[model samples]
Target: MPEPKEIGHQIKFPNTLMGLFKKGWWEIPEIMASSCLGLLGIGLGFIAVLNYVKNDGDNREYKKVYMIMRPDDPRVPRLKNPVYTQYKG
Candidate 1:
């Protein structure tokens, strides 16, 4: 019976940078284009996260205003006297 082949010994890895280039898998233009697109995606993602955080603060402010303005709303707690009374001159 034939001996079973070793699993990891068959996998070939380049020992040097020159050997890697000789493999025909590393094209300069394709690498540059892919890297640029990856950077652009990361930048856009960062901007989206920042915008979401900023908008979250604005949303909280709007919710506070809505609750105060519509005290009669079931969601808002009932109070004997309103928090913001008009100032009389």
Candidate 2:
């Protein structure tokens, strides 16, 4: 994997956006277009995470046996029925 410095160094690229924009009027629209693409990526990533959480079923809790005893035991009647409850991922 890339080192932290190598990964984070790209943050400085945007620092030159203003300087690059001032270099020519034609570049303004290109810069805006590139920024829009970056925003689109961020929005898509957010939506994907939201959808994953909403549809995820494996992370939920479900009823399961916690104890067992002979069927003829008098305490069998006290055995509580297991139930399920909603779980948010």
**Candidate 1 whole-model C-alpha lDDT, 0 to 1:** 0.61
TM-score of each model, in listed order = 0.35, 0.34
* RMSD, every candidate, angstroms: 12.6, 17.7
Off by over 4 Å in 1: 1-27, 57-89
> What is the per-residue lDDT of model 2 for residues 4-83, given as tens digits with 9 covering 90 to 100?
55553332224376766655444477877788899999999999889977765233234363544566777555445534
Lowest lDDT block of 10, candidate 2 = 6-15
**Candidate 1 residue lDDT tens string, 3-87:** 9888654435478986665443444667766878999999999999999876552434223344445646753343333466676
State the displacement of the C-alpha of residue 24, model 2, in Å, after optimal TM-score superposition.
10
